[model samples]
Target: MAKSLLFIPDISGFTKFVQTTEVAHSQHVIAELLEVLIEANTEELQLAEVEGDALFFYREGELLSQEKLLAQIENMFTAFTGHLKLLEKNRICPCKACATAPKLELKIVAHCGDIEFLEVQGNRKPFGKQVIEAHRLLKNSVESDNYVLISKELSSDIELPIYYYSKVFRFKQGKDTYDQKEVEYIYSIIDSNKLNISEYSKAKEVVFDKPPGIVFDRNFAIPAESLLEYITNLSYRHLWVHGVDKFEYTENEVTRLGSEHICVINNKHLNFVAVKKKVKPGKYVYGEMTRSIPIADTLYQFYTISPISENSCSLKIELYWETKSILKKLLITLFAKKVLMKNTKTGLDLLFKLTEDSRSIPSSK
Candidate 1:
């Protein structure tokens, strides 16, 4: 048996918060906050499991200094509060979950004792009385909603000032009563200011009104480079796109960044212009387009090509455009989405067939 520290950082007011908030948004907030807490793990700490709204962590071998252990606890508290404030300030949704996210708080319990490690089904399982004691400490009579509770068993090993801020509690456990003096460190009394968010200071940025309307994905039995060439080069686009009679460049240039093409689809004229945004060769191409339709001022489009093997790749096309009027939104939701989905599916199928054919000619150099 070896000595180690057992830690459980749990969220307070979780049940009440969830009950008073929207289901989907509350679930998202909980997940995000949990992720933020888990990201505070240090090399000295080992994450054991995420037990619902709490994170169970422990470190084996030599005991950590009291100063270092307290510092880690403070770090987690600060992270939790910082993320909570950021979400509170940035949330635009009017749901109760988004509006009351800042009300959530964190509390942690720490203890140290002997534990024997065992491997069961390729997973490490820590078995000891200390583990059970640490969990029981979570239900202690600490009056503060957000505070750190360290058991007297572990505090005895640390040379820290505990007499100034300690509390004693007696509770029953499994037909047996136990008494232990614990230390409480209130969070708000330490430093109760909101953290400066310099990295995410967006004061004058236009947010998109809505997400993408349709997303289509497929795997092609061909190289990404070859498929990208077929998609980008207008000389080859007319062969795969249905009802496209011609695609001629306006400036006598090829289809590329800042390039424009005049397309006649079944005698209905439309102009297509490209403004390259972010391009990762053989991986993805993201750009904006201005067309003849009134589907917002510009449409956002991206093609993500993920290579599965040396000769096969996956393609995901995302289309995003906003409708201004309520009638337009209703039309898009009721009818336009189906039409767009069908057209997108047809285009991808044609591209797949054309790319798979051995006789398909390469774009001219």
Candidate 2:
């Protein structure tokens, strides 16, 4: 029988990241990275399981050629770092999870050997000594967190050289003893600059020439970052924003620039995309734009949070609308503006009350 391949791409620093930052946001960040790595798989490897911060994949019949295997590793690293860069550049949240996400790293381990299969309640999985060895190799004496390690057995089988040097990879020999047995491997520390990361869409920062048509301000007895999260996180929208039949968004995704959500009201879907604008240095802003409102061709709403003290902040809500039709403009000037102001004020009042009531509740770490 042909040898099988065992591949694992683990997110380094995940434990520290989750323990030190906001739990919900950190989980979202890790989930996004894991999905990115899974999408980067080009060799058609079977996904065995998602082992928390890592993914276990196997190829049953054959191992990829040395060149193809190296390319696959590089592709995953590129995709992983590219997304970290995107998060760093496009983030709008001031929370620690969003601010420090770029500090995360990735390491991959690859091994090859003949494997046995076991069926567990209609699920087939690879098993045997090879799987154990592959996982043990993850605890090697590698100096860096960003790297690729190929077991000596697999490297020899695929004809990968001991001192393989490439633009992005420079392999060095390493070994460690596990369970009274020695395992050898070749490792390469990946340089982010050496890889060609793909480009992503940037956050759109719109410039406005006129003042907002409606503006309201309220002071909250919460920190600025916490207030920002409560407003930007669509999951909490239903509790504070009334008259919306439903709120739809990517539940596992962190709210960032270009992120979109839908507000279903009276059977009509209003699509809103996250946006940003210039604000004072000490203030944080979250803005959204929608074209679904009938009174105006375009509508924009911005929430600016300013820290007053360590435990208190003030929120300023601004509304802006634009239309080319004279009738629509007259209607907004005469009728819609008042209605918008009333609804916005009511929402803010509800939001204020919700925050006060939930102040004693322990938030997820």
Please provide TM-scores, in order, for all candidate models, with all chains considered together.
0.51, 0.96
lDDT tens readout by residue for model 1, 69-133: 76687678777888776666544333476678788888888788898777878878676777887
Residue-wise C-alpha lDDT for candidate 2, range 13-115, written one tens digit per residue: 9999989988888999999999999999999899998999999999998999999999999999999999999999989877788889999999999999989
Measure candidate 2: CA RMSD: 1.5
Q: Count the backbone clashes (under 3 Å) in each candidate.
A: 0, 1
Off by over 4 Å in 1: 163-191, 194-200, 203-365
Minimum summed lDDT over a 10-residue window in model 2 is located at: 356-365
Question: Using lDDT as the measure, which candidate wins?
Answer: 2
Query: Which candidate has the top score in TM-score?
Result: 2
How does model 2 score by TM-score?
A: 0.96
